[model samples]
Target: MDLESFLLGAVYYYGLFIGLSNFEFDWNTGRVFTSKRSTLYAIGTDSCISVLYIYYWTGNANIVDAIFGKANLLHEYIVVIMTGLRITTGLFTLIHRWYQRCKMMDLTAKVVRMYMARPQVKRMSRWGILIKFISGSVTDGLQMAIILNTMGRVEPQFFLGLGLQYWISVILNMAMVQQYMIMLFVRTQFQLLNSELRQVMEETKEVQLNRRHQGVFMTRCCSLADQLEDIARIQDELQTIVNQLEKVFAIRAAMIYGGYYLSSVGTSYLAYSILKHGYENMNMTLSTVILVFCWCFFYYLDGLLNLYGMLHVQDDYREMMQILGERTLFVGLDVRLDEAFENLNLQLIRNPLEIKVVELYDVTRRSTLAMIGNLITHSIFLIQYDMEHF
Candidate 1:
């Protein structure tokens, strides 16, 4: 384990803390309403999940002996392994938060820079936080209700059997909230940079007079260059933070998303079996269906929002470059701003600031939209095969 991971182990994670301490946290008066409650929930859920893990680990359990005994041996094994992964991810996220807090440079200054500069950014951050909290609560509550309702029909301890699934979803939900916050942070910083760049360029243009003001123009150019460098440094720092986050979340994302895709396929294959078995229990099958769709919707919406925010940030950067290029047209003053602009542009272009999952694919609008369709196609094939076989 790295120093960070070791440090994380030594510290206790209250509610799987996604170390928001690095950001603008006001511990004095700012209260996290759900923190305490969620910690209790985490403790309870872990207790139940631990029992399942022990069962599987000690060979006291097998695929066919798992909950419901409905799925094939391979399917059951995959579910258990994935569940373990999900729990581990939730804990790691907390550990990561602590590590980032202790070892990394504080991001409160960077986050505050944006919040102070843009009212809209502040408004958006509030709305983003509100949305994540509400949606996360509603989805987890609904899923737990559905699972308990579905399985409670047959077994009273059904909820305990799926405790891992519930908390895993919660952890993933919280992680995505962190991702969204980072995206917002980057966008705001870029927006600030873009605005400042335009202002500087315009000022330079206004100061540009016929030949005699060469020194004044040079001074203005130099000032613009300094500002650009400062903003670029922040932008680079933001990118570094994002790359680090991607590395941290990559495996978790892969497991979560891969599990989503597999569930899509599983639902397709199992729908017929469920319908047949549940013909008399319409409520049960319907709840199961709703639960699956809920998960899909959650993953789809979260992915889209994150992708949109990132693309928006990049678009803002492109617009800044365009403005710089246009302003350079009539500039006969000095070459410093032009050179600085070129250098910054090159850096931006080289980085491109794209997000990815396990370096698998660029997180883009087209790619995200395609995945939904891919799920549909793959699900249909699986359903068709099951229909033929059974």
Candidate 2:
């Protein structure tokens, strides 16, 4: 199957598993198929699942675990808070998907068309997807198995609850992967567009070099105008896709980033505790610590991959803007060509296609570094507090 088919198929099946959707997508065409009855049923099921999930976790572990419990390890509280944040983020993502399903479908269609137009550049292979799937499955499965085995005599109800939790986590993780792929696809289109523009600019300069006949020069200028108009139209569509992507993904991205921060702080604390005090001091075994850190390594790696993917989008947009700036506007070119260039430049300025988190800030290198700085600061403060108090 093609990349789009594989990606959408995974989303459709995973959505069904999580009650995120009941819609079907064509394997070849990327068309969404759904009916009122199915959508209503899916919504009802999703609501029930949400209610059940919240209820299960609420009674399973309360906030008191962090504050009043006898086992007040520094990471115990962090784990509790991480669980809450992850569940909240998952719920938000599910609801957001339902709310923005139409736009997602539209965006998918546009992206699929772009893929079809340039199949040669579709470099993603099925093996890449399979490897990712296997790696995540193995890591999370091992972690869950370790937890269950450590508990001793896991009941069916508890196992099912954990299973549901696993499903939610997997879906949320896949959502990040999907968002990264979307950005990758957009970046590819931008590259193609920039290449085309560069070629046109070269041709324009070549025509300028050999401008012996007035008729030939005028004809070439008109052709340049048409090419600019076409590129501008494509650029406009890409901008729309980028906007819709932000609308569909911004809140989820913010939530995921919050989840990442929590996970990082929590896991870092756990690793620190294990290292500083030893697992025996915390009533944990070496194996448990090893497994926890192993799982966390993969999880953090996934988050970093998505974060870097967002950074690449910003990088590519900058490159495109530079390419546009290099365009030497030929004198006496059609007025329409000047207008197209002006319009394109204005759009780029106004609606820069940078991956943003809820319209608050662009995910640039500086912002990411600042976030890491804050994470380190918070972690150090927590470690010091634990040293003095606990």
For each candidate, the alpha-carbon lDDT, in order, equals 0.60, 0.71
Give the alpha carbon lDDT tens digit for every residue of 24-92 in model 2: 556357566677766887788778768888777667544333222344555676776887788788887
Q: Write the per-residue lDDT of candidate 1 for residues 161-187, one digit (tens) a residue.
A: 465556556666656656666676677
For candidate 1, the per-residue lDDT at 364 reads: 69
Candidate 1 deviant stretches above 4 angstroms: 1-52, 55-121, 209-219, 267-296
True lDDT of residue 96, candidate 2: 83
What RMSD, rounded to one decimal, does every model reach? 7.4, 3.6
All candidates' TM-scores? 0.71, 0.85
